[model samples]
Target: MKLMKDEIETRRTFAIISHPDAGKTTLTEKLLLFGGAIREAGTVKGRKNSKHAMSDWMEIEKQRGISVTSSVLEFQYDGYHVNILDTPGHEDFSEDTYRTLTAADSATMLIDAAKGVEAQTKKLFKVCKMRGIPIFTFMNKLDRQGRDPFELMEELENLLGIRSYPVGWPIGMGQSFKAVYDRHHKKLELYNPDNPKDIDIISLSGPDDPKLDEVINDEGLVAQFREELELLDVAGDDFDVDLIARGELTPIFFGSAISSFGVQTFLQHFLSLSPAPTVRESTIGPIDPKTREAFSGFIFKVQANMNAKHRDRVAFLRITSGRFKRGMSVKHVRTNKPLKLSQPTQFLAQNRSIVEEACAGDIIGLFDPGTFRIGDTLVEGEAFEFDEMPHFSPEHFAAITVKEALKHKSYEKGLQQLTEEGAIQLFRTYNKYVEQQIVGVVGVLQFEVLEHRLKGEYNVDIQLERQPFSFARWIDGPSKALATLKEKQRNLVTDREGRLVALFENEFQMRTAQDKYPELTFYENSFYKKSII
Candidate 1:
């Protein structure tokens, strides 16, 4: 048990989130570089370039140079077992990002220095706050001319409603960019653009060291930098570790992820400050990692057909409590049955190796034989589910048809499997006399992915025509009210589970129905409340 506790404490699981093109994948590769997970950091320059990001393993992602799904990688750094959840940064994949956050104990919110708080970043930031996950900000893209660090800090507080404390401050901007002042150690790490290969550490007598003046080579810039430091010292928020753990404050680090500057410093500081796997909430109660004896975990994500030859699926489970050994039998809490725990694997993106044992905070991949859903639970002892996993309402809708009559079976099978992975939502509706298959996604790019996967994975082609409906709301009300709603609007459809949904062309259409049928209740998401997401 002591050994198990040690294993849990040594693990640090976190997700990196940002808007698209904020250098998120770049930062993940650099962190992997520090972990020795890869010999060289793979560049995400497009498929034709023959080098793709290590975190993005999907072929579609390789071609598009954008991540549409989350990737998990586990490695060891400085005696700490690190599990990095590399999430999709695009706004289209925000739902995927939200799902990935549940398995993570904390998150590193990457921000583009030029564009401080972006739309997607703000959206994901709220989700992080919903779960109360501690956020550490990395103001990226310092290699180019960018925003004022002080303004960026203020934006975090004003726009995102979180205060930030800089662990290190940049010395200059743009071509004159020189070093980062490590406030804690009172040292300067110089940056040389000509030789941007390694970090140069220089001992400074103080912030006003003449050695720093020699490095900057500009007297006016030195005076301005010193004044900014004095102002920050006088007026900035005090470093409160407790507030940081509570997600109330963020420790900000400024660097360019593309150039790999200040990344090592960020990694070293992040490992020391980040929390280990903490207590996880379940239906029964709070499950404490320090005391629990039985192995338990929940499935946060499910990926299907990762390997073309194997045509297999993986259920990514984050162990909540206790220890798991190979070939152990655990109870499937959702189905109330015993499930054999065999063939557990750990990942470095798509590359994986079978792990003999894993403890709390470790995410392990179990070979899924089309059984696990997004929120299913597996436990060795008490049976309780972690119920916070949410079902988001899809905004974009389309009607899909099999391109060939003979390929109906293939289309159905492919659609079922893809929907099961939670890449898109499946629905059924009627057009005149025939039932039509409808697919919905939060973003339209998923439609392309759906088409691509159907053709590639299952060898079926689909004709996906866009629908006018912009919103879907699950209905809960008296049978008479629902019947009336369907009769009047003819906008009613059912989700995969046969839950009745009203597809509205616009909000006005929804409002007209609501005013007419007062007995009916509309819900944005299927089961969870608004705050839970």
Candidate 2:
């Protein structure tokens, strides 16, 4: 077996983002297929019950055709190691997407060619911008009926605030879509199932080429195309045509992913153009929970494995910097918990390989930290602790009550376990009666998963109640009496200009310690202020 490099390594990691069903998972599967990870491609809708798609892990995801939790997959192409973070596209899982993005250097923003840029796509792109991550846009579903690619390009620029040049151009649209003209190669590559081993790139100005004839269909487009060709002819310039191809114009690729058409070309494009880990900038910090100067890595994901007889936990890690080795003790940032590293494993889907140590900027796995919690940073000493990635509080919340009266007591334990694994957040309301609420971004789809997992994994059945409007305000005084009286009482509210004026609640608030009174908290309360997330 060939050993990896001794001088650490070079790699490229990217989180794939898209609105739901824009084909992010399918695109990921195609990339993996081309990289020789799987023997065959699995469809989102399966023919047989036995064949499971690699990207969809949870039973709920498989049944619903959506991604809930993010999954990591690795493949080597052209001597470059690529780590792919496949994330959920639904708005409910947006926080998960953002947290996962922190571990990546760049992102591939996928949009449906038919629908153009959707709401979630724009939101995720802004997040990438905020994190200073470069983005590569993939206009997918070209085979579906849609507007012109040019219009889509305009939308991308206008909405996402990014300059997108096509890397490939589609030969046709809808059912007629057959080939992708490579802008870089200056040739049209036709997809051939029988010739999967070698893809043939054909020249454009050749004899009676059937592919070229098939591509130049629309009369208006044909006229413009010939005009461009003639302009190049008059310039006394030997137009390589490839130069036009090399520029950042969108390279449209055609073919159906279901048929495995043009999939190989996409893989070729990724291996050729996608930036690897070595090229990306690295951020280093400490592992200690008490301080920020030490080295600590954050575990962004944890999966509970209670499949049949196997009971184990899979921990996903993004090492900010420094080094972590097996048997070394590290502090868990969230709860000030200390953990002894057992074995560090490099995970690829379900398969894992043991590694002696993981260094800065590396995304790897840890073998069962028994009591692992998501968002906990593993640091060497007290000084290396850093804030967890900023996860948006769940927008839509629901009150879940036990369906079976007898199971109500056990539900909290099971639900708590789920939340501890970072599946969701459980909030205990300080009302007269204890009301445990599951707060999270609610995509209609993930709620299904939440209910399904509750039943399947925990064997608990619960009812859900969609919540109503709620907001938090910083008060000048502290008292249940003050909190109660602040009704219709616009006392004082602060604005962006730092001017405090009348802010009203349902009533006026009372003062506990009039001296220390209302300090006022904004969107950030205790946690964000403490961790600086």
> Which of the numbered candidates is closest to the native, going by highest TM-score?
1
Q: After superposition, how far is residue 95 of candidate 2 from its true place, in Å?
A: 1.8
Question: TM-score per candidate, in order?
Answer: 0.96, 0.76
Q: Candidate 2: where are CA atoms >4 Å away?
A: 1-9, 46-50, 192-199, 203-256, 278-296, 306-308, 322-324, 331-338, 351-361, 367-370, 403-410, 432-441, 470-519, 524-526, 531-533
The residue-level lDDT of candidate 1 at 521 comes to: 89
| Highest-lDDT candidate | 1
Identify the runs in model 1 with alpha carbons over 4 angstroms from their true place.
Answer: 430-433, 486-489, 528-533
List of clashing residue pairs for candidate 1: none
Q: What is the lDDT of residue 11 in candidate 2?
A: 57
The per-residue C-alpha lDDT of model 2 at residue 37 equals: 78
